[model samples]
Target: MKRIFLIAALICSSIIVLQSCSPKTTSGAPAVKRSGVTGNWVLNNITFDGIPDIAVKSFLGESSYKCFIGSTWSLTNSGNGSYSLPSSATCAAKTQTIFWSVNAADGTFQFKKLYQGDKAKNVTEGYRLMLAAADDVNMTIKSPIEYGNKTAYIIMNFSKAAK
Candidate 1:
């Protein structure tokens, strides 16, 4: 009985480990094709909390215009797990480096922007963009930001252009 229980436990743990370490597939092999992310992706919803006051102040005045930002994110996959955002429609500020990464094995996408501030040297933060479905044209990304009294979220939705 003891040996049997031990074997069962081992098997369970091994399965867990394998699943955790397994290579992630975004949309399987086809998803990572040479021209991946060509289709349109809308920002359906965004959820984030624990944002600093400083960040919130940046978007306060233009609350109405906030929605206008990030309208489109055109992704052009260079190769491997790397890609580029040829143009980001709604970003008002100027920046130097923009980085994009994807977990082809897992189907996870991330975009980062590096900025230099007065107090800090260089701060880089971005969100993880998740696809809705294989055929779904909507995608959601979440990021936290501070609102009026407390922290709140700024969720936006984006729709893909029809071919």
Candidate 2:
């Protein structure tokens, strides 16, 4: 009977030692938060193929690039947005409503024109801008445009507009 008690006590003590010596497990690091792209943005700078281009600068004029400046590009949570350019001496008055989306997998930014009342036909192909960098306040996008016979990439820098 004494031998049997000793054996049971040994097993119980071994179990307690094992439980105390076991490694502790903890939760992993917290998940990273992704930055959103919905906001009003204004044009900050423009470049071509990472360098300044004289032709594009001349074409875009000193004031506006395809009527992008002065007008605010408003992006919504639903990926729908609009920008209105008032009638100016250089360009006509126009309002453009568009649907935009950014593909995280490929870092592709796409913009589809929903309505352009000034134009006779709606734009179908739309613009595909490659997202270079985007944060809460700043965004950089690259767009390939056919300049004459050669292709040139237009890099546009945008900053979040103040309320």
TM-score of each: 0.38, 0.60
Off by over 4 Å in 2: 1-35, 50-66, 86-88, 116-124, 146-151
Give a tens-digit lDDT track for model 1, residues 87-144.
Answer: 3344444223334566655455555554444222243555554432333455443333
Candidate that would win on lDDT? 2
Q: What's the CA error at residue 87 for candidate 2, in Å?
A: 5.2
Residue 162 miss distance in model 1 (angstroms)? 2.3
Stretches of candidate 1 exceeding 4 Å from the true structure: 1-38, 42-55, 59-70, 79-98, 103-108, 113-135, 146-152
Q: Write one digit per residue (lDDT tens) for candidate 2, span 10-74.
A: 99999999999999754442221124567888766666783346656433222446455455678
In candidate 2 the C-alpha lDDT for residue 128 amounts to 67
